[model samples]
Target: MPSKSPAQAALEKADKKANSSSGWFSSSSSKYEEAGDLYQQAANLFKMEKLFREAGDAHAREAECREKCQESNEAAQAWWNAAKAYKRGHPDLAIQALSQTITHLTKAGRFRQAADREKEIGQIYLQELNDLRKACESYERAGEWYAQEDAQATANACFKDAADLHADLEEYPQAIARYEQVADGSLSSALTKYSVKEYWLRACLCALAMGDPITAKRNLSKYSSLDTTFSSTREAKFINIITDAIEAGDMETLTAAVYEYDQVMKLDNWKTNILLKIKKGIQEEPTII
Candidate 1:
């Protein structure tokens, strides 16, 4: 018979700790502590052997033991450890552990930590899982927490990320709404004053793409009336040209104006794509009146 490796030995020990953790602790609080400590030891051993799955399980066991021993904070820490252990090696288990961490942290009133987890989950959802919608929700939740903390820049950034993801998924209404929110907020900030027109332009473009003439006209009017700086700018003039063409159902005029803008600004692929979408929307419309 072949001899068991050190990893096997560690796993056996971890299994024993997990199996016997449920013993009746009739007034002896030390039992839970002993089991929790043993589980943590096994978890370290598993990690040392690169058995991340086993390590995650052991760390989770440690958390459960700590919880039963009334060590709430330690339990939360152990759960966090489990999440980290599972993060790289196990996708499903990692999210589950993160959810557990969020629950415990929220119950403990650690809003900041909870927000961090929300942001982390958002990143994982987008990068690892490729679930864009869930990622948007997670980022939006983080934005809300940041807003509560009065971190306006951070909050707006998170909101913008969520909006971008929504737009990438072609959720135009959501993108438009988020863009409008950002534009409205930017108008009130002296530091962000110069960015106001750009934000409104993005919102207007989204409206046009979605074939919402009312919204496009409203945003165009908003741009013209925003401030002296905006009303007199080249971007404001471009909006007027595009809006007039769309309102008149004149595709030729719209095309010419877009070409002019592109020639001057050298539109990036994304901007060109948005403009193409606007043109398509115009072609599909029966009449703007």
Candidate 2:
């Protein structure tokens, strides 16, 4: 028979306290509170032993106990600790823990923290799990929450992250929607209005990638109306040239335009990939007699 370690013994004691059969002597809330403390002790012991998974489990138990006691702030902190513990061993479980933390934070009216946690969740999904779909959802949620909190800068950044992921996934309509959204919001202030051109360019590129020349031309006109300076920018001219080349099925002109633009403003991998797709589409079209 193997002897129980200190953490294991502490967990057993926590379970017993949490499940006590006392009907009248002790209050349930008090029992849960005590159990939560014992669970915290167990978690600390597990962490000291470098048993990260066990520590995470113990912290999760503490969070459950805190929730039962109606201590939302404590529960949120406990869940955050659980997430950190799980992050040391299991990224997926860490994401789940962070989700619980976000829930509790939101319930406690700590939306800024919840929004920040949402971004963390998105990064984990995108970088660690390689799940762009989930990452996009998380970023979109974060953006919405940040926007509600009047943090437009952070909100736009989150939206841009989602838009980039949508573009990468070839979800052109969704990508265009987010890009235009950010561009529209950027119109309100001089500090951010300069960025509207890049956002509109990305949206225009997405429209072109969708083989919707009408929408691309319409968006170009809309952008020019929304920002009087847009018509004078290199981005607007590039979009116009690309739209024309695509309409004429002139691959050489399109390639040359992209090359010229890249010399001044380097296109990133995402834009380069989309341009390649657009080029492939042009090449695959049937030649006129």
Candidate 3:
């Protein structure tokens, strides 16, 4: 064989480097392995050149390649750690890590793997932590993620639970907001009608208890409109007796008011509100007529 020229040798070396770089872009099993090796080589090159950003990108690329080739758990952990490091006191970092974990695990169908992490995040913000808003956000994300996986019922339940939690915290507006969403999204018409009627009646009774006859009358009117059972002559007569007692300011009329309120509460359309208000008034020593 003829001796090779220096230019030929240099060209051969350049070709070899090109082949290694091209290997990273290959998807075949053998090529994937070669890609891994090439990624490592690129990382070393970046590190040697003191190009930290490029080095990080190279490392990330290697990790991504490994993930694409069926090393999901390793990839998730790697991205999670990187996200944590990058987050270092920055909320954006935490969000990125959490989002990446969800994305990777969901794509890989590793629901169980992501579930604990999601729950961990929720607890960190909700329970042991004092960030109710953040906790709500986490729950919302979990619900959304589950929904995307075709778990509609589970997602609905989760959102409902979060709404309840918000309610329990005396976050009435938030509770009402979430409840409205739940009501709009999944509640059956029958249930929605029942809930509206029930709550309106409760409001009416509360107004009556507070001697706010105007509000009470308005709510009662609304309740009656929604529920035919409340429009009965018997219920109307009972409501009339209370109205007359209120106008009379006659404590002597309380006995009749109590009897009428109790009867109204027993009616099918009448919710538990009338009974609650009567009970509350009886406790307050000035029975609201």
Candidate 4:
């Protein structure tokens, strides 16, 4: 028979400790604390054995024990450790661990840490799992939390990621709404006000993609009225040119306008891809006799 490895021995000890009740003289909290310590020991031993998934499970058990003891901070830390251990081999499990971390952090009034973990969950869903919808949901949650914390820049960034994913998924209405929300939020801030034009431009692009030139044109006018200076900006002019070209079914003009704007400010992949979609829409419009 094969000898038990150190990790296996530690795990057995942890299981035995966790299953046993507190002595008659000791409190239940003491039992849970003892079990948590044993679980932590098992986790460390499993890490030494390079059994990451097992280590993650041990950490999760520790977190449960901590929760039973009403130790929110300790539970949050254990959940975070579980997430890190599960991240490389089990992305879905990592996300679950992160969700628990966020929960405990929130319970402990650690909103910023919870928001940060929410963003991490979004990245894992986006990059590791290719689950765009879940990623968007996670980002939106993070953005809301950051906004509540007055971290506007970080909030807007998360909102943009969610909006971009919405656009990629062809959920134009959602994309437009999020962009407009971010743009409106920025209008009152001197530092962020100048960036609102870009957000409005993206919203217009989403409207155009939905084959709603009227809405797109109206949005440009609305932004001008709201910002007062929007009408004179390069973004406003570009949107006008693109809207007119779409109305006239002039694909060349649309392409040239995007190229001109890109010369001033190089468009990123999200903008380039949306513009390509807009151009395709123009090409598909049937010419009236």
Judging by lDDT against the true structure, name the best candidate.
2
Q: Which candidate is the best by TM-score?
A: 4
Give the per-residue lDDT of model 3 (tens digit) for 116-184: 456556755654456777777677767676667666556655665566455444454555455445544
> Best to worst by lDDT, what's the order?
2, 4, 1, 3
For candidate 4, the per-residue lDDT at 36 reads 92
lDDT of 4 by residue, 1-289 (tens): 9999888888788788878877889998888898899899999998988899999999999999999999989999999999999996899999999999998889778888999999999999999999999999999999999999989889999998899999999999999999998998888989998889989999999999888999999989998899889999988899899899989888788889988999998999998999889888877887889
Check candidate 3 and list the clashing pairs. none
Candidate 2, residues 147-226: lDDT per residue as tens digits? 99999999999999999999989999999999999988889988998898999999999998888888999999998998
TM-score against native, each model: 0.79, 0.89, 0.37, 0.90
Candidate 4, 141: how far from true, in Å?
1.8
lDDT per residue (tens digit) for residues 1-289 in model 1: 9998665676566557546645464443566677788788888888888888988998898888788788877888888888888886586787788788888887888877777878888888888899999999999998888778777777777787787787777788898788777777777888977776766777777777787768787767766775657767777788778888888888889889988988887877656788888888777767635
What TM-score does structure 2 among the candidates reach? 0.89
Pairs that collide, model 2: none
TM-score of 3: 0.37
Report residue 73 deviation for candidate 1 (angstroms). 2.8
Which parts of model 3 have CA positions greater than 4 angstroms off? 1-74, 77-99, 103-120, 168-171, 184-186, 189-289
